[model samples]
Target: MHKLTEIIKYSYNLNLLYVEDNDEVRNSTMIILREFFKNITVAENGQEGYERFTEQKFDLIMTDINMPKLGGLEMISKIRETDNEVLILVLSAYNEPNYFMESIKLGVEGYLLKPINMEQFLVVLNKVIQKVQLKEKSRTYMSLLGQYQEVTDNSLIVSKTDPTGKITYVNDEFCKISEFSKEELIGSNHNIIRDPENPKEFYEEMWESLKGKKQIWKGTIRNKSKSGKSYYVQATIKAILDADGNIVEYIALRSDITDIMNQQKQLEDLIDFSIKPILALIEIVDYNNLSKFYGHKEISHIETVFANTLLQSVPNKKLFDTVYTLSHGRFAFAKDANNQDIDEIIDNVKKALHNVNSSSFEIDGKVFDISIRVSLSYGDDILENCTYGLQKIKKGHSDFFIANGLAQIEKKQAQSNLNTLEMVHTAIKDSKIISYFQPIVDNKTKEIVKYESLVRLITPTNKILTPYFFLDVAKKGRFYSQITQIVFNNSFDALSKTTKDISINLSALDIEKENVSNMIFDLLEKHKKDASRIVFELLEDENVKDMNVVKNFISRAKKYGVRIAIDDFGVGYSNFVRLLDYQPDILKIDASLIKDILTNDYSLSIVKTIITFAKSQNIEVVGEFVENEEIYLLLKELGVDYSQGYFFGKPEPL
Candidate 1:
């Protein structure tokens, strides 16, 4: 009982895997383990235990040594091949020299003799638990240290020095850029590459900060290379302190910005042209500092090569083609052009730039692959529009735009959408979005067969608004999924109240997103008894880009006895191929085909063809927008299985 208290206090959060071949021992031990551990997984033998270890993460593993299929020593050895950190304990009936030595060789934390002494077992278990706590602490520290090392190695010139200012460490980046070997840099003062541009007071202030052992000191510094070349670095230096809080060393991280400084005027000169310039802003996506993978000189040369490619590939170069380096990993191009020829020129440039960006280059037997995001603008305000276009692309939208009157109107609409989106979000949060039911009836019997659930938003003044007023705004922002969920819950609640079947609409985007799709499955499970009466009304005109996701959703829903119906079947990309692929249980013929069926023979023949084909596949056809007795009687005479519109009943609050 005393050991149990200690175990619960120290090891209650840990997950353990217990492997024992004896069923009686495993069951009894598991019951005891369950008292202490938050989670415990039991396996019959070493082989099964090893499989579980591969599938899940465990804090500790305890196994009997002489288990069948695989022994404790063998499993531990296999585990050590990949992970040597997990604590392992072995229980054995034999305390022989061979078993002890093999266990030691496999790095088992503890070897306990079986027919257990509970007190001694607790002592060893506590010791192993302490080690586990220490390992976890070290792992967190190591993770933080690794992150710092990655940033320093990939993007900065790094160096370290002793408190007395003698160099102690210099990374390869510092060595390559300074034209000094590691051996030559060590033990030398940091002044080896110091340029004479800064006044003496600059050095005085730096020294004062270092002597006071302040936190980080940052400034731009000029330095000279071995070949008498000058460069600039944005440097940050910090004191590294020991456990006693005394400074032991100083570490510095620097970014070389000499090329960026040199190229600023070139970019300004290119942008000073009077012609209507078409600007293309090219941004590097996978930039981890090219200098880390290549020497500074080689990186500079590669940028020059890329600039030349841009100059050559842009269409109609003779009509004012110019390239400039905006900054590290970004470039801008300007071309003088007439308005009529701008679109074609931009298209050719995009194709050429895409080819360049997609290809990889080899430098010094190492491969450098590049990916880029390109944005384009064609107008007098080229630079501003280019920036706007780039922001759009970064937000995962279209990358190219013409800064015309239409674009300004779209910008206003987007801003207006933001205000409307807040209202939609509030409606969802406050449960103001409600479902309205519209009935679909049997064409011959005229009895209600199913009700389609439509969403309505209640305004602050208590006026009700339909989906057409707000759904587009919901899709444009992040509230579409939330709105879908609200509609789903309201529809399901209505389904629970009545025995009538219900149909709810879903768009292609809802099916495309896994989270929304999973929410749908959860809702189905919540109403399992009435799932058969629920029909998913998908618009036939909506584009199904990911057919596999759609197919999987259908197959899973069908397993739960839910029905599928394609709405608006005669409009936009609808055809028999989609019908053959999905094989839905109901086809709701589009309103366009039915509204004009009496006057238009083409519409009549199409409806006839749809009904004929649906009959062949055992799929019921529903005629939509049936407004009058003549159209209703014609649909009934035409053998339509269902009808819905004003003729049946308008959508109303349920």
Candidate 2:
């Protein structure tokens, strides 16, 4: 009513302590408090309130000052000694100057008159809530900023040199990159890392560029580490000036670019031998789309198949030395063959790729075919030419070879993927990824029975992105495992506090990874007693190559009283015998089968068969995507135990 929208939302999440001596007043105020805060701790007097405060944390506090057995001021004094940030609101009957001064000195949030009027109380409460919210937001912002800063600092080689070019300071990253200890670097000349590869004129030009305090010198520098190993860095070096506008010191920030340089050299080596090196860039087609349907491990397996095909097709090991994968969905290789013979080689490679493309990848029992497109370049600069060809492929010229005119694309898709991966890493590092829950209701009783936990990426832009959008890139970047761990820990911890069961989906690839598997088992063990409330749903599409691994995981998980469910039961292999062997507690009929179940007899038949089979095995059946009352009622008649869909409720944050 007061248009206090921000404060109201913040209050719903915060915990508050209200301390008062009078029972009637406390009860009356608590009725209003319950409408705002989710958790409210009440105490009879200041001493008891202080004890409660010590045991737990609260975002805000409200207390009456004139209470017996230790007044609010004395208790608050004790609290302020240990905790200065918790917002405190004091209620008092007196308007005494001394009381106001003492309260202000103790940093109390507000002083309100006793026999509190509802309208006036809400106004003061709103102000205090705003303060609490602002402080909380500030803390969260600083924490995430700190995490990003730490990552950035750890990655870049940082160093400072005095005007005379002697090293004044160096970060651990600088020492690490240079393979030198801090002591070895601090007093050393900056030229200690200079390499012979750079000409004398290059140093002269750089010094001239830095003659002005603000002029930034940027270049690729070849430097030798302490071990005498040569490396290259893309560096930005500039002077730090003093009040007099004179250069007092210089600072440099650089990133290692040795791999790219090595790749270029490898290309050059092939060309100088008169072998007529050709660069071929292979990209996994629809890799992001595939990741939505599959997992990272499966994607890796598919890429391996593509590589093997390339080697087999080319057969001339001397011509095609090694196939290097740059990132997920992208690969590069060089062949020592001239343009005259390149056509025939391309035909052979295409044939091989076609053969592999005909076959399908089986992940979590689900089978799907993957295809790759190739771009070839015979330009003088291998890296540049290859990247140009890659750009062509990205622009819908995939599966073809190019021999000329290499123009750079404005923004490379691979660069975009890299940026997304960085954001994901930052989110995970800051604990910003979170779980959203959707209700699963009993079909017959029409009562919510459980929830399905879905993971979301909270982007730096404050936009919420679903798994299908970014999960593929994350999986390719080897970040899927970390995300899985975050979702598991947060979801299971939340489930442990409630009686309602919740289901979490896990990829077979996730289960196959020893580290991720162990983390899941550890969480299960931690919530062992409440394990019955946890359900692990494995999609039926993925092929479990190692049945024993899945069996072992299921057995151990079941031992903790957790239940297993076969998700999307009608998709992929859909093998009943295999399902029987896994003996999942719940069979979630695929949405594709249920979406058409009402109008398509074939879909209905499949659903009936799945439900009948599940019943025979004493497994409960859940029908997904039951959109309308007709489907809901039909599912109830078909003996479906539970149903989840937009009809019930969309997935939401808790």
Q: Which candidate achieves the best lDDT against the true structure?
A: 1
TM-score, each model? 0.46, 0.45
- Per-candidate Cα lDDT values, in order, are 0.78, 0.77
Per-residue lDDT tens digits for candidate 1, residues 50-106, read: 999999999999899888899878888888998988888888877565676567667
User: Candidate 1, clashing residue pairs?
Assistant: none
Q: Candidate 2 residues 1-654, lDDT tens each?
A: 355565567687888988999988888878777878888999999999999999999988899888989899999999999999898888877756567657767887666666665545666677676666678789887876765556546666788999999999998878887988989888889889888777999888898879732579999889998888999887889988775457989989776767657765665666677557667777778775554433333455666665655566554455565776545466667666754587776666666567656666554575656677777766466556666776666666446657355543333667788898998999988877999998999877889889999999888878899998789899787688788888888788877556789899987656766678889888878877788899999875445667777788888888888899988887532243456457799988899989999888757866775676567667899989978889999999989999999999988885
On a 0 to 100 scale, what is the lDDT of residue 276 in model 1? 63
Candidate 1 stretches with Cα past 4 Å from truth are 1-382, 386-411, 541-549, 572-577
The pairs that clash in candidate 2 are 363-542, 363-543, 364-541, 364-542, 364-543, 365-541, 365-542, 365-543, 366-541, 366-542
What is the C-alpha local distance difference test score of candidate 1? 0.78
- C-alpha RMSD by candidate, in order: 22.6, 26.9
